[model samples]
Each structure stands twice: as C-alpha cells, then as structure tokens.
Target chain A: MPRPAKKPRKSYHHGDLRNALLTAAREVLEERGPSFLGLREISRRVGVSAPSAYHHFPSRDAIALGLAEQGAAELATCLAAAPANPSGSLLTYGEAYIAFVRANPALYRLMFGEGFPAVSQHSAAIRALRERSYDIMKAGLEQRLPASELPIAGLFLWALVHGLGLLLVDRQIVRDGDLEDIIRRVLTLAGTGLLHGRGRDDGQSGPPPPPPGTRSA
Target chain B: MPRPAKKPRKSYHHGDLRNALLTAAREVLEERGPSFLGLREISRRVGVSAPSAYHHFPSRDAIALGLAEQGAAELATCLAAAPANPSGSLLTYGEAYIAFVRANPALYRLMFGEGFPAVSQHSAAIRALRERSYDIMKAGLEQRLPASELPIAGLFLWALVHGLGLLLVDRQIVRDGDLEDIIRRVLTLAGTGLLHGRGRDDGQSGPPPPPPGTRSA
Candidate 1:
C-alpha cells in the first residue's frame, strides 16, 4: 500500500561527506529556498550518489538541521562582536542582527522559520549553537532588567528586533536610507518604553513633536 | 529551448468556482502544508479538471494570495474584538493574536511566511484586506502615543507582539499556564519601559524578586 523508503548505498568512511553535504545544503538554501531543497539535488551538486548522501542526512529535515546550525553559528559571530557596554552594545547587536537577516534571508528563514526541526529533534551540537546565540542576548538584557523581569524583557526585546527584521525582509515596510535610524529609535523605545527621560538621551526622542510635516520611517 | 507554459483549457464561467476552490485550498493548507499545495490536487478534490482549476487560479501563487486574504480577514476579526481601553485592549489583542497563530500555524505561515507573493503583487482586494488589519492596530496606538510618534510606536508594538507570537508558536520559549499574565507584563513593559511607575502600577512590578526557588518562563 505504501512505497519503501530509500536507503543509502555504497557506505564508506568518508569523514568529509557530512561537511560536504552541509556546504551543498547551505548553497541550495541561499540560491533557491527551503522548498527547493532536496537530498538528490544536494548529492548531484556534491558529485556523490544519493545513497552516500543519505549516510549523513536520512531525510531533508536532517539536512535542514545542519543548515540551521550553520546559521546559528554565523549569528553568534555577529552578536559576539557587540560592544562591551550593555545598553549601547544592544543597539549595535540589534543592527548587526537585523542586517544579518536582511543579507541572508533564505538562510535566516531556514534557521528561524517554520518547518525547521524542533528542540527535541535538534542534535547536541545544533542545540548548543542555538543557545549560544540566545545567551548573548540574555547576557545583555540582564544588565538592563531586574532579575524578576529578565525573561519577559528578553522575550519583548527579541520579538521587537526579530519582528522588525522580518517585516523589512518581507517588504511590508520600506525603509529608504534610515534603517539604522529606525533601529535606534525602535530599540531605544523598547529599552525604556518612553519617549522622554532616559530614552531621550539616545537622540531618538524629543519633547517637541515634529513641526507638522517631518516624519520618521 | 524550453517547454511552453501550460494554458488553462476551455475557459467558461463557473458561478461559485472561485469560492469553492479557496475553501478547498484552505482545507489542504490546514491538513498538509504550503509545499503540498497543487492546483491539480485541489482540482481532483473538487471534482474539477485541471484546466477548470486554472480558470479560477492561474498559478499556485494566485491561490496562495487567496488563502492569505482569508488569513488576514480572520486576524482582523480577532483584533476588532479587542476591549475599548487602548492599553488594556492591546494586551487582549496580543493574546488573541498569539492564540490565532498557534491555532492555525500552517495558515498563518501561508499568510506571513516567505514564498508568498509580495505586497506590490497583491490585487486591490488583497491589499485593502491586509491594510484593514493593520489599521486596527494603528487606531489603537493613536489613543496612547503622540501623533508624531504614532508610526514608530505602532511599528514597535507590532513587532513586539508579532515576535512574541512567532516565538511562542515556534516553541523557542515555553510559557506555562496563564499566557495572558505574560502578555500583559510584556506589553506594559513595551509601553512604559519600566518595571515601576507605569509598568509597575499595573500590579506586575515589585521591588522584591521572585521567591528563591521560583522561576519565570
């Protein structure tokens, strides 16, 4: 009543096969999209038989986890370069974070979008890579929020930046030359939730409303 | 050098064909996923020929736009039911928004996820429906923010709630019972950027941290 699953053929200990497949998978994700990915296509690109490809990734989802790990590691590098000042560094980190997604939208979607494997499905290496990225954000938020508010604060800020990045990438809102300007205003508002006082020092706020015509994106 | 694109056969008006196809497409989106959608399969389910299906939907993307319209309309209904108080209403809207996404994840992804057509590509009907949903949020924010800050404030709040909904659906962060408690706290913080005064006055703030063994999700 059902077809049998395909199995890898000609198995051998080629230590680089996994890495090779991962490289090929990332390329596929970048060029086409998540939907266009296939183990057969990856095998063809890598000059290997489909069965050999299956040695490392039993299904398309397995290869997706590999690509997601690569994406997480790259994001970690971006956040790692954030400035040492927690408040100031978060703005920088937010810029870098949003830029990273804009630059590699397809890969970012693979890592964070639906259809990616769940936590229980992630391998140890993948899990650690993902956590490392979140930890960087958590470390920064710990400085600004009370211990009791850390979790909610983390979710709030992460959602704000992440949502902005997605909106920009989706082209729902167009930002001309003022992406960083918008980011600064947004993260500032997110940090202090006020248009005056502490947030005012960031240069994104003022007591005077725009004199009728001026507008910020 | 290339095969010709397939054309819809025998164009004839079916009074309710468009509506019927959309209903069927939604069912497919709910059962399988975006990737599994195909006009031919939809036609088979609807007892129509492939050419007949094409008369209603020229391409897969055309059908996707139809589905996205349905999703946006549903979202508008949820937001429209918000309570009258701007601040309090936003929290209720956030809970409803997140719950909607969680309940219809596949449809939500179809509407907002990548591979869906861009806004410029949307028809007049589709664009209006999408904007109608956003207008509700903008109107709610108008009550609390200065007119000059409305656009930025709206974007900030949208991204925050959107991000939270995505994260919760993605299961990146686990919130146990009483999702509304978390939603109220997060929105209050976003509105005031403080754990005291504005955010604290809502009964969500305290000088003392959680008892030693307690933890927030």
Candidate 2:
C-alpha cells in the first residue's frame, strides 16, 4: 500500500500547510508504522520547510496526537454507521469496529498503543474525539439497558471490542470464512454472557492452593 | 516501594548469576517502571561486569522478554488460584486479574504493553506463558460453558477483564468502595449480556448518515 509522494509545486500559494502536513504524516505512519514517523521526513514529503512544519507540529508527539485525533474521528464515523436496532446494533457496532481496525492496523495501534498518551492524558482535542466515539456506543446501549447500567456496560462493550480487535491485529485469531459471521458469533457469546449470567448455575471450585515453597515477588 | 540494591559482593562467587540478574532486573522494573530498565544497571546491582550482563541478555529486548515471561508466570499463578466453583469461578478469576494489575501496574503494563513482540511473533517461552495464563481462564470457563462455546467464550472473558484492567490502569475508570464488588457488577453486565441478549428487543433505529462533506481517508 505504498503511496507515491505528491509532486512538489511552487510555494506561490500556501494553502493549509497544516492539513497538508497531517495528511502526509498519516500516510507515512500507515505505510511505515509508528516507529518511522519523523516530522522532517513528513515535511519533506509535503514540500514544506522544517520551520514551517515546526510552526504547526512542535514535536513528534504533536504529530502523533494529530493522527490519533483523525483516527478517533474515523472510528466514530464507523461506529455511527452501525445498524441502530437495539438487538443487532451492538453486534453491528462491534463488526464495524473490527473492520475499521482491520483496514487501518497501524493507525488503530497508534490511537491505542503506547506511542500515544492514555485517554485521560491525551490533549483536549484528542480526548474529546475519544469520548465522542465512546458516546456513540453508549447512546446505542441506552436504548435497551437501564440508565444506571450505561456507564459500566459501555466500558465492558468497549473493552470487548477493543480486546478482540487487538487480538486480531496481533494475529492471535483469524477472521476465518465470513468475517461478519465470526464477529457475530463472538459478540453473541459475550453479549449473551452479559445479559443472562449463563454460568450462574455451575458449581464453584476454588483455585488450587499455591505450590509449596512459592513466594510472592 | 523501594527495593534496596543488594550489596555488590566479590566476583569470586558466580553462583546463580543468571537468576540473580533477572531478579535485579525485575526489581528495577517494578521500582522505576519499565522505561528505566538497563542491562548495565541491573548487572551492576548484581556485582557483575557489563560483559557478564551481556552474556545473559544480549540486548534490552531480551531483558524485556524475560520480564514479560516472569510477569506471565505471575499472572498465571494469580489466575490459577481463583475459587474454582463453576458458578462463581469466572467472576473470581476476573477479580484476581484486576487485583494483580492494580498491585503491579508497571509489571502488568510490561507484560501486555508495547514493549514486547506481538503474541504471534513472541519467542516460544513467552508465547507458552501467555497461553498458559489464558488456559487457566479457559479451564474455568469450561465448567459452565458447553465445549462448543468455550473458545469464543474464553476470549470474551479475557477481553472483558483485560479491557477493564487497562481502563483502570489508564485511569479511565475508578474502583470505588470494595474492589471485588465493582468487578462482580461489571462482569455481571457483560456475562449476562451474552447469556440473555438483554438488548435484543429494543427497536432498530438506523444510525444517522455521516455528516455532510466528510470524505473517507
């Protein structure tokens, strides 16, 4: 998926160098993965001087944050397009989420990976984008569950989808045969486990005691 | 909590130098966080020369792999000890998982964080440790779930707890009052959702179309 560098043109017209830089940086990130991203390299691709690039992005982290902001927005769009029926919406949302991650593995990694700060620590704009994405899921959940359940339920749903997405990206599991079918079955297992407490009747078996001579670290 | 470095002893004793270096490395990782781990510093703490240190861990990635392996073993131990009653075992395992993360945030991060290779790419030992940890959860899930449902069911459970643990680590969610009680409630939501499809009946409201003028990347 190599993207050829755009031909450099005269600087006679300075049209949104900031956006041009972001687009170029994102292309580099997706093509080379997060580790290869360099502000100078990205600037060079966009035919901008280092000083001009610095004016918009002060550091590598700033550029990462910009990419993450874009990623979150894209994620929100994907989530928003999920089917709205309460019965199928969660599954649709889950499917859409996995699809997005599959399409943009590196960008998805940057959004949640150690390369960026945690959600709580992200810059204001990035944080808002993340929250907005979560809100789409929450609003979908709101139609079926009690208001009291929304917060933790939202967290659980987010974790389920996020974890599966990571596992897929790591190649821990493959989306075999039909992609949506796999998502549907996995989501059904999780969603049902949450709704009915399916294992409630199974007898309890306490974990075996630690082997003798074991010492806590 | 600070672990004072052992008094560097005479070079006359080379007893268990490998284990000694690993122990020191773990102490450093837990104390200063993963970012502070350096082979020379660890070897120095253990009264070893730089070349001696290199003998055990050729590079920092090797040391990280070692730490991750240790963390996986520790996590496996925690998972193995949960009360085994089929009815409550999943919840108990979930609680233990979160508690382990809360107790050793940095080590937990090291085990699951960006430092190590992907699961598919990990060396044999690291991958084995990871699978061993997951198998403990699967064993618990087995007692209650049909054999047909075990695989995906186990994944959902792992994702649920892992996601919650990460959210707690990131400070995206807080554990208020009794810790286990909160975990119990969150698990109930996800597990029950899977069992009953509680959100099944809500009307289908199609997700709104993407906002105008937005272009896909």
Highest lDDT against the true fold, candidate:
2
How far off is residue B175 in model 2, in Å?
Answer: 7.1
Error of 1 at B103 (Å): 3.6
Lowest lDDT 10-mer window, candidate 2 chain A?
Answer: A207-216
lDDT per residue, candidate 1, B63-115, as tens digits? 88888877888888888886757546566666667778888877877776765
Tens digit of lDDT per residue, candidate 1, span A1-217?
2111123434344447777777777778778777677888987787677888776777778788777777777778777765546435555666667877777777777776655544225667866786777667767755543344556666676788788887776667754747656766676566555221234223533333322321111
lDDT for position A212 in model 1: 34
Ten consecutive residues with minimal summed lDDT in candidate 2 chain B? B208-217
User: Best-fitting candidate, measured by TM-score?
Assistant: 2
Segments of candidate 2 deviating more than 4 angstroms: A1-17, A38-53, A117-120, A174-179, A194-216, B1-6, B9-17, B31-52, B118-120, B174-179, B193-217
| Residue pair clashes in candidate 1 | A192-B193
Clashes of each: 1, 29
Accuracy of chain B in candidate 1 (TM-score)? 0.72
Off by over 4 Å in 1: A1-15, A48-52, A115-125, A194-217, B1-15, B47-51, B115-124, B194-217
